[model samples]
Target: MSTTNQFQQAAHYARVIAAIARDRPVPPATLSSLHVIANQLDNAANFLDTDAPGPLSSLPIAATEALWLAELFAEDNPATRLPTDFTNYVLHRITGRPLPFPEPMFPLSDRLALQEVELTNRLQYLHDDTDMQVAHPDEWLRAVLSLWQKLLRLAEAVREDNSRSSHQ
Candidate 1:
């Protein structure tokens, strides 16, 4: 894919995160992370469009994870599908078990957005409720973080794959 296309994919990932954010309410942590990704994407796209001097490596890192995550969680989602090798990496990150095939991400804009909101609200309550607080949703948040990391792996893997293949 063209560099432009890669950046566009990053935008697409950000859009999905934004969709998730709009779900209910975003936790401060997840909200901050999403905001950072959004800002990074916005800045990266502009720089990339201008033919900036930096390597293409920087832009793809944060965007790859959720695309793969969609394959795992939102399989019915038509918007994002993970490449096979990338899918394997994501499966390893999210679950120890291996996957059989790639799946499409089912688009759940409102549902995801609300889920973030609810999670954030619940997280806040958990933080405040000294008497009734439950455990922080570390696994839940970790899942999201893991998905986000998928892009970074793919980005590096692409560079490494090219380097190795070019030696032939």
Candidate 2:
């Protein structure tokens, strides 16, 4: 995939995260689009790393976990779907998981704006670093896997919270 597409995908991811952070209702279409993008990323990873294609694979594993989490979050019952931002806040307030983003004290618009900027900046850094990845296939693999890992961790945190809430 081209770098432009990657940049757009990064923006899309940021928008989704921003919506989640604001606790705004994410449309079904948005979730579906995200699922598609996640699959594409997985495909790209698989194409790059063919030697280790199994359950024990490295990069593909992270992408697969992210894809599954995306599917789970896309379930019909929105109430059961937890947003990572909210999950982080709950964990921070109750369980001591650090809040990595800015405090959500501002108005909704302001918060969303700030989050979009922050996420975009981070993604830009990742994108700029991809120049090295181009020269080293291993670096590319690591970069993709790292991005997926970060995203998956957020999703996993939310999933865990959902499970805990359900049992209570």
Candidate 3:
């Protein structure tokens, strides 16, 4: 997978997670587990440039898979909720920036006001929703796979754009 593809995958996962979190009731313990998984994914992505195969190739998929699993387990365990703090932390770790409380619209301003609002709304929904479980884990996995493909493509585009700009 190219760097662009990786980024796109990462972005896609971020979006999915955000969507799942909305209008969902996540327990604190579950939130902690998700945070741990998110942290692992971040670590894996950081080591992608090393001599090894690098976790970047599979971290996003793993994270998404874990989330779906958690959702399954959530039926008997409503306590598996992800806290707002955990969600914010994961976003920060992945994007190298604080999670926007209210996600900003495209063409954002220097201030992250819009971003904050979006995040806040999502968080509220996640906290309030009663039915947050995944209906099909396989489908979720497939979606993540698609995101990974997109990430590779985006990474390539970024690299090419940079190369072209530098040569001019």
Candidate 4:
């Protein structure tokens, strides 16, 4: 897609997310759409120029917004926690060991995109070091594929829930 088109699409999704945030009981279908949009934002960041007011600027905001909406959905049901199994696995696989989590100095926000942020940071870390990239190509690929699969599964789950609700 053209850069302008990507921007327009991202803006449209942002508006939709904002509208849903204004009301209660945000629908699973919308969240599913948000997940897809978030992926697109990530993809756009990959191929687009890192210009000001562009995909690079928009991506983190979009990620934050999508994560916030997903948290809203999870709040209604304790069972609907954010997906972490694949995140943890990818983290371990990339780092070659389980990472230790130190206590946060400040309280964490519900809107925090914990998994996405951590994984992206790790991926960036791997990408920056030529030696690491060459030495662990499989790990890097696995992390990328695993993250995409996790995102797809999350979107599919929301879609499945939406279908089930409509049928009921």
Candidate 5:
């Protein structure tokens, strides 16, 4: 696939994670963090679809503008207390641990390509997770933060490869 395709897919996965969380009834703090993540992903992805010029063209405008937001959210001691598990999860993932996600309950849909006719407008809400099912919302948010950085790096590598191949 082309770099653009990889970037697009990376963006989609970011959105997929956000959509998944949106379906759950997480606390406002967690939701706020998710919102920051989703917006950055969306902005970065959308910017890639444009013809912007610069040394940091690979990064989306949102990524540049809000570069430190995720770091702050993942901080051990922030103005607002972050869930310890969430902080741990983010730290571990940043240190190279894999992201944790349950097998999708349904097939992954390409929301960008889905036609209105194929879309289901039903409010697909998730029940409050049991102690075992989720354990905590912070873990989920932390996983998302990790995923964003991972995807960004993957997209950069893909774009670099594509540039090299094209120049040849």
Candidate 6:
């Protein structure tokens, strides 16, 4: 799909997430549609793994813009907490180590510390700049798209590395 179409879909999903964050009621159909879009975007990112440029490398700028928007919308709202299991899952997948329950897992290890720092900075920019008083749907959508793009790149890289190692 074209970048324009991808941005449009990302914007739509961002709107859904924003509504949910705001405690505004989201229709079941809209929620389902957002899920579908998420899955599609994930799949597209996966498919782009075979190519050199990779899908995500082409998306950082847009994703960065989107993240700025999401930060604004999420500022006044309670910080959206990730499930405990999510962190555990990431730790296991990245380190191949079994983490005991209640033990803190550092997501930014030596290898990925720089990347983590960059991502945090971007998020901070979004949080600090978002004007919750003003409904900036465009900004919110841009932020979400940026995040989705980053996820796509990470997924592709992991998949590619796994595939190469398995063949060796």
The regions of model 2 sitting more than 4 angstroms off are 1-123, 162-168
Q: What is the overall TM-score of model 6 with all chains considered together? A: 0.29
- Tens digits of per-residue lDDT for model 3, 4-96: 444444444444554444323446665655454444444333332232324663434455454444334433343433322233333332445
The number of clashing residue pairs in each candidate reads 14, 0, 32, 0, 0, 6
- Kindly give the stretch of ten consecutive residues in candidate 2 with the minimal lDDT sum: 86-95
Taking every candidate in turn, the Cα RMSD to the unseen true structure, in Å, is 19.6, 16.4, 18.4, 14.9, 19.4, 19.3
Pairs of residues at least 3 apart in sequence or in different chains that clash in candidate 4: none
Candidate 1 lDDT over 1-168, as tens digits, reads: 444554444344334433443342445654544444344334433443443223534433333344433333333321232233323322232233442221322223444444445444453443344243113223333334344344333444444554664434
Residue-level error in angstroms, candidate 1, position 98? 14
Order candidates by TM-score, high to low.
Answer: 5, 6, 2, 1, 4, 3
Q: Give the lDDT of residue 7 in candidate 2.
A: 31
User: Which is the leading candidate under TM-score?
Assistant: 5
- TM-scores for all candidates: the values are 0.25, 0.25, 0.24, 0.24, 0.36, 0.29
Considering summed lDDT, which 10 consecutive residues are worst modelled in model 4? 99-108
Best by lDDT: 3
Give each model's whole-structure lDDT: 0.38, 0.39, 0.40, 0.39, 0.39, 0.38
